[model samples]
Target: MNVSQSADTVWNNPVGRLLTLLVGGGLVAGVLTIYPQLLPVVRWVVPVSLVFWGASRLYRYGVADSLSLAAGCLLMLGGFTYASYLLISMGELAGTVAQLVPVVGIFVEMFAAHYRNQG
Candidate 1:
Protein backbone atom coordinates (compact mmCIF):
# COMPACT_ATOMS: atom_id res chain seq x y z
CA MET A 1 0.00 0.00 0.00
CA ASN A 2 3.11 2.22 -0.09
CA VAL A 3 2.61 2.78 3.61
CA SER A 4 1.89 6.46 4.16
CA GLN A 5 3.25 7.77 0.88
CA SER A 6 1.15 9.47 -1.78
CA ALA A 7 1.71 9.90 -5.50
CA ASP A 8 2.98 13.45 -5.18
CA THR A 9 5.00 12.57 -2.12
CA VAL A 10 7.43 10.25 -3.81
CA TRP A 11 9.50 13.11 -5.18
CA ASN A 12 9.49 14.81 -1.82
CA ASN A 13 11.25 12.08 0.13
CA PRO A 14 12.75 13.78 3.14
CA VAL A 15 16.34 12.65 3.54
CA GLY A 16 17.74 11.62 0.19
CA ARG A 17 15.62 13.81 -2.02
CA LEU A 18 16.35 16.94 -0.03
CA LEU A 19 20.08 16.28 0.11
CA THR A 20 20.13 15.40 -3.57
CA LEU A 21 18.46 18.70 -4.37
CA LEU A 22 20.85 20.75 -2.30
CA VAL A 23 24.00 19.06 -3.52
CA GLY A 24 22.68 18.69 -7.04
CA GLY A 25 21.83 22.36 -7.20
CA GLY A 26 25.38 23.25 -6.36
CA LEU A 27 26.75 20.70 -8.80
CA VAL A 28 24.57 21.99 -11.62
CA ALA A 29 25.42 25.57 -10.82
CA GLY A 30 29.10 24.79 -10.81
CA VAL A 31 28.80 22.96 -14.09
CA LEU A 32 27.02 25.90 -15.62
CA THR A 33 29.62 28.29 -14.33
CA ILE A 34 32.72 26.27 -15.12
CA TYR A 35 31.82 24.07 -18.04
CA PRO A 36 28.88 25.20 -20.02
CA GLN A 37 29.33 22.24 -22.28
CA LEU A 38 28.17 19.97 -19.50
CA LEU A 39 24.94 21.77 -18.82
CA PRO A 40 23.01 18.95 -20.39
CA VAL A 41 24.49 16.44 -17.97
CA VAL A 42 23.56 18.52 -14.94
CA ARG A 43 20.19 16.81 -14.93
CA TRP A 44 21.89 13.49 -14.39
CA VAL A 45 23.68 14.24 -11.12
CA VAL A 46 20.63 14.59 -8.88
CA PRO A 47 18.87 11.50 -10.19
CA VAL A 48 21.94 9.44 -9.49
CA SER A 49 21.87 10.66 -5.91
CA LEU A 50 18.21 9.77 -5.86
CA VAL A 51 19.15 6.29 -7.05
CA PHE A 52 21.41 5.71 -4.10
CA TRP A 53 18.78 7.29 -1.94
CA GLY A 54 16.03 4.98 -3.17
CA ALA A 55 18.30 1.98 -2.88
CA SER A 56 18.49 2.84 0.77
CA ARG A 57 14.78 3.27 1.09
CA LEU A 58 12.79 0.76 3.12
CA TYR A 59 11.73 -2.35 1.25
CA ARG A 60 8.18 -1.50 2.20
CA TYR A 61 8.56 1.41 -0.14
CA GLY A 62 7.44 -0.71 -3.14
CA VAL A 63 8.72 -3.15 -5.73
CA ALA A 64 8.66 -0.46 -8.41
CA ASP A 65 10.77 1.78 -6.27
CA SER A 66 13.33 -0.98 -5.94
CA LEU A 67 13.28 -1.48 -9.69
CA SER A 68 13.90 2.21 -10.12
CA LEU A 69 17.03 1.90 -8.04
CA ALA A 70 18.32 -0.97 -10.11
CA ALA A 71 17.64 0.98 -13.29
CA GLY A 72 19.42 3.97 -11.86
CA CYS A 73 22.43 1.90 -10.97
CA LEU A 74 22.54 0.44 -14.43
CA LEU A 75 22.27 3.89 -15.93
CA MET A 76 25.15 5.05 -13.82
CA LEU A 77 27.24 2.06 -14.80
CA GLY A 78 26.53 2.70 -18.45
CA GLY A 79 27.34 6.36 -18.12
CA PHE A 80 30.62 5.53 -16.45
CA THR A 81 31.46 3.03 -19.13
CA TYR A 82 30.72 5.51 -21.89
CA ALA A 83 32.79 8.21 -20.25
CA SER A 84 35.59 5.74 -19.75
CA TYR A 85 35.45 4.78 -23.36
CA LEU A 86 35.72 8.38 -24.45
CA LEU A 87 38.34 9.65 -22.04
CA ILE A 88 39.35 6.76 -19.83
CA SER A 89 40.82 3.32 -20.17
CA MET A 90 39.40 0.02 -18.87
CA GLY A 91 42.19 0.04 -16.25
CA GLU A 92 40.94 3.38 -15.01
CA LEU A 93 37.52 1.90 -14.26
CA ALA A 94 39.13 0.61 -11.10
CA GLY A 95 40.25 4.10 -10.17
CA THR A 96 36.81 5.44 -11.05
CA VAL A 97 35.22 2.97 -8.66
CA ALA A 98 37.69 4.10 -6.05
CA GLN A 99 36.59 7.66 -6.63
CA LEU A 100 33.13 6.51 -5.63
CA VAL A 101 34.17 6.18 -2.01
CA PRO A 102 31.76 8.76 -0.68
CA VAL A 103 28.95 7.29 -2.76
CA VAL A 104 29.68 3.80 -1.48
CA GLY A 105 29.77 5.09 2.07
CA ILE A 106 26.41 6.77 1.71
CA PHE A 107 24.90 3.62 0.24
CA VAL A 108 26.37 1.57 3.07
CA GLU A 109 24.97 3.93 5.64
CA MET A 110 21.57 3.72 4.01
CA PHE A 111 21.71 -0.05 4.06
CA ALA A 112 22.71 0.09 7.71
CA ALA A 113 19.65 2.19 8.35
CA HIS A 114 17.55 -0.28 6.43
CA TYR A 115 18.85 -3.22 8.44
CA ARG A 116 18.62 -1.40 11.74
CA ASN A 117 15.02 -0.64 11.00
CA GLN A 118 14.40 -4.27 10.11
CA GLY A 119 15.85 -5.50 13.39
Candidate 2:
Protein backbone atom coordinates (compact mmCIF):
# COMPACT_ATOMS: atom_id res chain seq x y z
CA MET A 1 0.00 0.00 0.00
CA ASN A 2 2.84 2.37 0.94
CA VAL A 3 5.89 3.29 -1.14
CA SER A 4 8.24 1.35 1.11
CA GLN A 5 6.13 -1.79 0.82
CA SER A 6 5.97 -1.43 -2.95
CA ALA A 7 9.74 -1.09 -3.09
CA ASP A 8 10.17 -4.14 -0.89
CA THR A 9 8.02 -6.21 -3.21
CA VAL A 10 10.14 -5.20 -6.16
CA TRP A 11 13.17 -6.90 -4.63
CA ASN A 12 11.24 -10.04 -3.88
CA ASN A 13 11.23 -12.78 -6.50
CA PRO A 14 9.71 -16.21 -6.89
CA VAL A 15 13.25 -17.27 -7.70
CA GLY A 16 13.67 -17.90 -3.99
CA ARG A 17 11.13 -20.70 -4.18
CA LEU A 18 12.86 -22.14 -7.22
CA LEU A 19 16.19 -21.87 -5.45
CA THR A 20 14.82 -23.86 -2.53
CA LEU A 21 13.57 -26.54 -4.87
CA LEU A 22 16.97 -26.78 -6.56
CA VAL A 23 18.61 -27.13 -3.18
CA GLY A 24 16.36 -30.02 -2.28
CA GLY A 25 16.92 -31.66 -5.63
CA GLY A 26 20.65 -31.18 -5.31
CA LEU A 27 20.64 -32.87 -1.94
CA VAL A 28 18.86 -35.83 -3.38
CA ALA A 29 21.30 -35.96 -6.27
CA GLY A 30 24.19 -35.65 -3.82
CA VAL A 31 23.13 -38.74 -1.93
CA LEU A 32 22.82 -40.48 -5.25
CA THR A 33 26.31 -39.37 -6.19
CA ILE A 34 27.77 -41.60 -3.52
CA TYR A 35 26.60 -44.69 -5.27
CA PRO A 36 28.61 -46.01 -8.20
CA GLN A 37 25.39 -46.60 -10.10
CA LEU A 38 24.30 -43.01 -9.66
CA LEU A 39 27.55 -41.29 -10.57
CA PRO A 40 26.28 -40.57 -14.06
CA VAL A 41 23.28 -38.70 -12.67
CA VAL A 42 25.53 -36.56 -10.49
CA ARG A 43 27.73 -35.60 -13.41
CA TRP A 44 24.75 -34.36 -15.35
CA VAL A 45 22.97 -32.62 -12.49
CA VAL A 46 25.90 -30.58 -11.18
CA PRO A 47 26.79 -28.63 -14.30
CA VAL A 48 23.19 -28.19 -15.36
CA SER A 49 22.07 -26.90 -12.00
CA LEU A 50 25.02 -24.52 -11.81
CA VAL A 51 24.12 -22.92 -15.10
CA PHE A 52 20.44 -22.80 -14.26
CA TRP A 53 21.01 -21.24 -10.87
CA GLY A 54 23.29 -18.54 -12.23
CA ALA A 55 20.86 -17.65 -14.99
CA SER A 56 17.97 -17.57 -12.53
CA ARG A 57 19.74 -15.03 -10.32
CA LEU A 58 20.64 -12.86 -13.26
CA TYR A 59 17.15 -12.98 -14.67
CA ARG A 60 15.56 -12.28 -11.29
CA TYR A 61 17.71 -9.25 -10.44
CA GLY A 62 18.62 -7.87 -13.84
CA VAL A 63 14.98 -7.18 -14.70
CA ALA A 64 14.48 -5.07 -11.58
CA ASP A 65 15.22 -1.32 -11.59
CA SER A 66 17.72 -1.73 -8.73
CA LEU A 67 21.32 -1.47 -9.80
CA SER A 68 22.48 -2.77 -6.43
CA LEU A 69 20.50 -5.95 -6.93
CA ALA A 70 21.97 -6.47 -10.38
CA ALA A 71 25.44 -6.05 -8.93
CA GLY A 72 24.67 -8.46 -6.12
CA CYS A 73 23.34 -10.96 -8.62
CA LEU A 74 26.50 -10.68 -10.67
CA LEU A 75 28.61 -11.25 -7.57
CA MET A 76 26.51 -14.23 -6.60
CA LEU A 77 26.86 -15.61 -10.11
CA GLY A 78 30.62 -15.31 -9.94
CA GLY A 79 30.79 -17.09 -6.63
CA PHE A 80 28.36 -19.69 -7.81
CA THR A 81 30.31 -20.28 -11.01
CA TYR A 82 33.47 -20.82 -8.99
CA ALA A 83 31.67 -23.15 -6.64
CA SER A 84 30.54 -25.21 -9.59
CA TYR A 85 34.16 -25.77 -10.43
CA LEU A 86 34.69 -26.85 -6.86
CA LEU A 87 31.79 -29.24 -7.25
CA ILE A 88 33.53 -31.22 -9.95
CA SER A 89 37.01 -31.16 -8.42
CA MET A 90 36.13 -31.48 -4.75
CA GLY A 91 33.39 -34.08 -5.08
CA GLU A 92 29.96 -34.40 -3.52
CA LEU A 93 30.65 -32.32 -0.42
CA ALA A 94 31.59 -29.28 -2.45
CA GLY A 95 28.56 -29.68 -4.65
CA THR A 96 26.29 -30.07 -1.65
CA VAL A 97 27.70 -26.94 -0.01
CA ALA A 98 27.31 -25.02 -3.24
CA GLN A 99 23.68 -26.00 -3.49
CA LEU A 100 22.84 -25.43 0.17
CA VAL A 101 24.55 -22.06 0.56
CA PRO A 102 21.97 -20.32 -1.59
CA VAL A 103 19.23 -21.80 0.55
CA VAL A 104 20.89 -20.19 3.58
CA GLY A 105 21.11 -16.94 1.67
CA ILE A 106 17.42 -17.11 0.91
CA PHE A 107 16.63 -17.62 4.59
CA VAL A 108 18.86 -14.71 5.53
CA GLU A 109 17.02 -12.53 3.08
CA MET A 110 13.72 -13.64 4.51
CA PHE A 111 14.86 -12.85 8.03
CA ALA A 112 16.05 -9.43 7.02
CA ALA A 113 12.76 -8.69 5.33
CA HIS A 114 10.85 -9.84 8.38
CA TYR A 115 12.93 -7.64 10.67
CA ARG A 116 12.54 -4.65 8.42
CA ASN A 117 8.81 -5.21 8.30
CA GLN A 118 8.69 -5.26 12.08
CA GLY A 119 10.53 -2.01 12.38
Candidate 3:
Protein backbone atom coordinates (compact mmCIF):
# COMPACT_ATOMS: atom_id res chain seq x y z
CA MET A 1 0.00 0.00 0.00
CA ASN A 2 1.02 3.60 -0.51
CA VAL A 3 2.02 5.75 2.52
CA SER A 4 -1.24 7.67 2.45
CA GLN A 5 -3.37 4.49 2.46
CA SER A 6 -1.24 2.95 5.25
CA ALA A 7 -1.73 6.06 7.38
CA ASP A 8 -5.44 6.10 6.67
CA THR A 9 -5.76 2.42 7.65
CA VAL A 10 -4.02 2.99 11.01
CA TRP A 11 -6.12 6.05 11.68
CA ASN A 12 -9.28 4.03 11.20
CA ASN A 13 -8.07 0.93 13.04
CA PRO A 14 -8.44 -0.45 16.58
CA VAL A 15 -5.53 1.52 18.00
CA GLY A 16 -7.23 4.70 17.01
CA ARG A 17 -10.41 3.46 18.66
CA LEU A 18 -8.54 2.78 21.90
CA LEU A 19 -6.97 6.22 21.79
CA THR A 20 -10.34 7.92 21.49
CA LEU A 21 -11.74 5.89 24.38
CA LEU A 22 -8.72 6.72 26.53
CA VAL A 23 -8.96 10.43 25.73
CA GLY A 24 -12.65 10.59 26.50
CA GLY A 25 -12.13 8.60 29.71
CA GLY A 26 -9.40 11.02 30.79
CA LEU A 27 -11.71 13.97 30.23
CA VAL A 28 -14.41 12.36 32.41
CA ALA A 29 -11.84 11.66 35.09
CA GLY A 30 -10.67 15.24 35.06
CA VAL A 31 -14.19 16.60 35.30
CA LEU A 32 -14.97 14.35 38.27
CA THR A 33 -11.74 15.29 39.98
CA ILE A 34 -12.64 18.97 39.64
CA TYR A 35 -16.19 18.42 40.83
CA PRO A 36 -16.26 15.72 43.47
CA GLN A 37 -19.76 16.75 44.48
CA LEU A 38 -21.03 15.21 41.27
CA LEU A 39 -20.34 11.67 42.47
CA PRO A 40 -23.76 10.97 43.95
CA VAL A 41 -25.78 12.53 41.20
CA VAL A 42 -23.41 11.03 38.66
CA ARG A 43 -24.12 7.54 39.90
CA TRP A 44 -27.76 8.08 39.08
CA VAL A 45 -27.13 10.06 35.94
CA VAL A 46 -24.62 7.68 34.42
CA PRO A 47 -27.13 4.92 33.88
CA VAL A 48 -29.51 7.34 32.25
CA SER A 49 -26.71 8.71 30.10
CA LEU A 50 -25.67 5.18 29.25
CA VAL A 51 -29.18 4.44 28.13
CA PHE A 52 -28.83 6.94 25.33
CA TRP A 53 -25.18 6.15 24.88
CA GLY A 54 -25.87 2.46 24.56
CA ALA A 55 -28.82 3.12 22.33
CA SER A 56 -26.75 5.17 19.94
CA ARG A 57 -23.95 2.63 19.98
CA LEU A 58 -26.39 -0.17 19.35
CA TYR A 59 -28.00 1.74 16.52
CA ARG A 60 -24.59 2.35 15.02
CA TYR A 61 -23.81 -1.35 15.36
CA GLY A 62 -27.15 -2.37 13.88
CA VAL A 63 -28.62 -3.49 17.19
CA ALA A 64 -31.90 -1.67 17.42
CA ASP A 65 -33.46 -4.23 19.74
CA SER A 66 -30.70 -3.78 22.27
CA LEU A 67 -31.09 -0.02 22.13
CA SER A 68 -34.80 -0.29 22.70
CA LEU A 69 -34.29 -2.43 25.80
CA ALA A 70 -31.58 -0.17 27.22
CA ALA A 71 -33.67 2.92 26.52
CA GLY A 72 -36.54 1.50 28.57
CA CYS A 73 -34.19 0.78 31.44
CA LEU A 74 -32.76 4.27 31.25
CA LEU A 75 -36.18 5.92 31.36
CA MET A 76 -37.08 3.91 34.45
CA LEU A 77 -33.94 5.01 36.22
CA GLY A 78 -34.50 8.60 35.23
CA GLY A 79 -37.99 8.62 36.69
CA PHE A 80 -36.79 7.16 39.95
CA THR A 81 -33.96 9.63 40.32
CA TYR A 82 -36.02 12.64 39.27
CA ALA A 83 -38.57 11.84 41.94
CA SER A 84 -35.96 11.38 44.64
CA TYR A 85 -36.91 14.59 46.40
CA LEU A 86 -40.56 13.77 46.16
CA LEU A 87 -39.90 10.36 47.57
CA ILE A 88 -38.26 12.06 50.53
CA SER A 89 -41.01 14.64 51.04
CA MET A 90 -44.32 13.72 49.42
CA GLY A 91 -43.67 9.97 49.35
CA GLU A 92 -43.14 7.46 46.50
CA LEU A 93 -45.50 8.16 43.60
CA ALA A 94 -45.00 11.89 43.23
CA GLY A 95 -41.21 11.74 43.37
CA THR A 96 -41.13 8.89 40.84
CA VAL A 97 -43.36 10.87 38.48
CA ALA A 98 -41.07 13.85 38.74
CA GLN A 99 -38.09 11.78 37.70
CA LEU A 100 -40.05 10.45 34.71
CA VAL A 101 -40.83 13.93 33.48
CA PRO A 102 -37.29 15.11 32.90
CA VAL A 103 -36.00 11.82 31.57
CA VAL A 104 -38.91 11.04 29.28
CA GLY A 105 -39.36 14.62 28.19
CA ILE A 106 -35.78 15.15 27.11
CA PHE A 107 -35.03 11.76 25.56
CA VAL A 108 -38.38 11.20 23.89
CA GLU A 109 -38.47 14.65 22.34
CA MET A 110 -34.97 14.30 20.98
CA PHE A 111 -35.60 10.74 19.79
CA ALA A 112 -38.81 11.75 18.02
CA ALA A 113 -37.08 14.63 16.35
CA HIS A 114 -34.26 12.35 15.29
CA TYR A 115 -36.55 9.80 13.61
CA ARG A 116 -38.88 12.44 12.21
CA ASN A 117 -36.01 13.86 10.20
CA GLN A 118 -35.19 10.40 8.84
CA GLY A 119 -38.66 10.13 7.36
Candidate 4:
Protein backbone atom coordinates (compact mmCIF):
# COMPACT_ATOMS: atom_id res chain seq x y z
CA MET A 1 0.00 0.00 0.00
CA ASN A 2 0.96 3.58 -0.45
CA VAL A 3 1.91 5.98 2.37
CA SER A 4 -1.57 7.48 2.61
CA GLN A 5 -3.20 4.08 2.78
CA SER A 6 -0.73 2.92 5.41
CA ALA A 7 -1.32 6.01 7.50
CA ASP A 8 -5.10 5.59 7.25
CA THR A 9 -4.84 1.98 8.29
CA VAL A 10 -2.80 2.82 11.37
CA TRP A 11 -5.05 5.72 12.34
CA ASN A 12 -8.26 3.77 11.83
CA ASN A 13 -7.13 0.74 13.80
CA PRO A 14 -7.51 1.05 17.54
CA VAL A 15 -4.51 -1.11 18.41
CA GLY A 16 -2.33 0.59 15.84
CA ARG A 17 -3.33 3.99 17.10
CA LEU A 18 -2.65 3.06 20.69
CA LEU A 19 0.67 1.55 19.80
CA THR A 20 1.63 4.62 17.85
CA LEU A 21 0.85 6.81 20.83
CA LEU A 22 2.78 4.54 23.16
CA VAL A 23 5.79 4.53 20.89
CA GLY A 24 5.77 8.27 20.49
CA GLY A 25 5.47 8.77 24.24
CA GLY A 26 8.28 6.35 24.88
CA LEU A 27 10.53 8.04 22.36
CA VAL A 28 9.93 11.42 23.91
CA ALA A 29 10.56 10.11 27.39
CA GLY A 30 13.71 8.37 26.31
CA VAL A 31 15.02 11.43 24.59
CA LEU A 32 14.36 13.63 27.61
CA THR A 33 16.01 11.16 29.93
CA ILE A 34 19.02 10.58 27.75
CA TYR A 35 19.74 14.21 26.98
CA PRO A 36 18.25 16.47 29.59
CA GLN A 37 20.17 19.41 28.29
CA LEU A 38 18.29 19.14 24.98
CA LEU A 39 15.05 20.03 26.72
CA PRO A 40 14.93 23.43 25.07
CA VAL A 41 15.26 21.98 21.61
CA VAL A 42 12.82 19.17 22.39
CA ARG A 43 10.05 21.63 23.16
CA TRP A 44 9.96 22.72 19.54
CA VAL A 45 8.91 19.21 18.54
CA VAL A 46 5.24 19.99 19.16
CA PRO A 47 5.01 22.97 16.82
CA VAL A 48 7.08 21.23 14.19
CA SER A 49 4.86 18.18 14.43
CA LEU A 50 1.83 20.42 14.10
CA VAL A 51 3.23 22.04 11.00
CA PHE A 52 3.94 18.71 9.36
CA TRP A 53 0.52 17.36 10.25
CA GLY A 54 -1.19 20.48 8.94
CA ALA A 55 0.82 20.34 5.75
CA SER A 56 -0.09 16.70 5.22
CA ARG A 57 -3.78 17.41 5.69
CA LEU A 58 -3.58 20.30 3.29
CA TYR A 59 -1.78 18.18 0.75
CA ARG A 60 -4.29 15.34 0.96
CA TYR A 61 -7.56 17.28 1.28
CA GLY A 62 -6.67 20.73 -0.07
CA VAL A 63 -6.98 24.21 1.42
CA ALA A 64 -10.73 24.02 1.95
CA ASP A 65 -10.30 21.50 4.75
CA SER A 66 -7.01 22.86 6.08
CA LEU A 67 -7.79 26.44 7.06
CA SER A 68 -8.83 25.42 10.56
CA LEU A 69 -5.83 23.14 10.85
CA ALA A 70 -3.52 25.99 9.89
CA ALA A 71 -5.16 28.33 12.38
CA GLY A 72 -5.03 25.75 15.15
CA CYS A 73 -1.37 25.11 14.50
CA LEU A 74 -0.63 28.82 14.66
CA LEU A 75 -2.53 29.14 17.92
CA MET A 76 -0.69 26.16 19.33
CA LEU A 77 2.65 27.63 18.36
CA GLY A 78 1.75 30.86 20.11
CA GLY A 79 0.56 28.98 23.17
CA PHE A 80 3.79 27.00 23.30
CA THR A 81 5.83 30.16 23.08
CA TYR A 82 3.92 31.66 25.98
CA ALA A 83 4.26 28.43 27.91
CA SER A 84 8.03 28.55 27.52
CA TYR A 85 8.03 32.07 28.83
CA LEU A 86 5.93 30.96 31.76
CA LEU A 87 8.44 28.22 32.50
CA ILE A 88 11.27 30.71 32.70
CA SER A 89 9.44 33.38 34.72
CA MET A 90 6.99 31.40 36.82
CA GLY A 91 7.24 28.21 38.87
CA GLU A 92 7.54 24.74 37.37
CA LEU A 93 3.90 23.86 37.97
CA ALA A 94 2.56 26.87 36.16
CA GLY A 95 4.86 26.31 33.23
CA THR A 96 3.98 22.62 33.07
CA VAL A 97 0.26 23.37 33.06
CA ALA A 98 0.70 25.92 30.35
CA GLN A 99 2.57 23.39 28.27
CA LEU A 100 -0.08 20.74 28.79
CA VAL A 101 -3.07 22.90 27.96
CA PRO A 102 -2.69 22.41 24.24
CA VAL A 103 -2.20 18.67 24.63
CA VAL A 104 -5.33 18.40 26.73
CA GLY A 105 -7.19 20.55 24.25
CA ILE A 106 -6.22 18.21 21.44
CA PHE A 107 -7.41 15.15 23.35
CA VAL A 108 -10.69 16.89 24.16
CA GLU A 109 -11.16 17.76 20.52
CA MET A 110 -10.48 14.16 19.51
CA PHE A 111 -13.04 12.79 21.97
CA ALA A 112 -15.60 15.38 20.87
CA ALA A 113 -15.17 14.39 17.26
CA HIS A 114 -15.40 10.71 18.10
CA TYR A 115 -18.62 11.10 20.07
CA ARG A 116 -20.11 13.51 17.58
CA ASN A 117 -19.63 10.95 14.84
CA GLN A 118 -21.08 8.16 16.97
CA GLY A 119 -24.18 10.14 17.76
For residues 7-79, write the lDDT of model 3, one tens digit per residue: 6776799997688779888998898999999877766664456446545544543434443444555554554
C-alpha RMSD of each candidate structure in angstroms? 12.2, 11.0, 9.8, 6.1
- lDDT of all the models against the reference? 0.54, 0.57, 0.60, 0.63
Segments in model 3 whose C-alpha atoms lie over 4 Å from true places: 1-11, 50-119
Better of 1 and 3 by lDDT: 3
Candidate 1, residue 94: Cα displacement in angstroms equals: 4.4
**Per-residue alpha-carbon lDDT of candidate 2 for residues 10-100, written as tens digits (9 for 90 to 100):** 5475775566678888887778766768776655654456446546645664645344344434445545754565545766776667666
Ranking by lDDT: 4, 3, 2, 1
| Per-residue accuracy of model 1 over 1-119 as CA lDDT, tens digit each | 57457534755778757776888888868879998888656545544554455444434343455443444454445445444443545466675663454355446546644755775
Report how far off residue 35 is in candidate 3 (Å): 1.6
- Output the better candidate (1/4) by TM-score: 4
Clashing pairs in 1: none
lDDT of model 4 at position 3: 98
Q: How many clashes in each candidate?
A: 0, 0, 5, 0
Best by TM-score: 4
- Per-prediction TM-score: 0.26, 0.33, 0.36, 0.45
Worst 10 residues of 1 by lDDT: 54-63
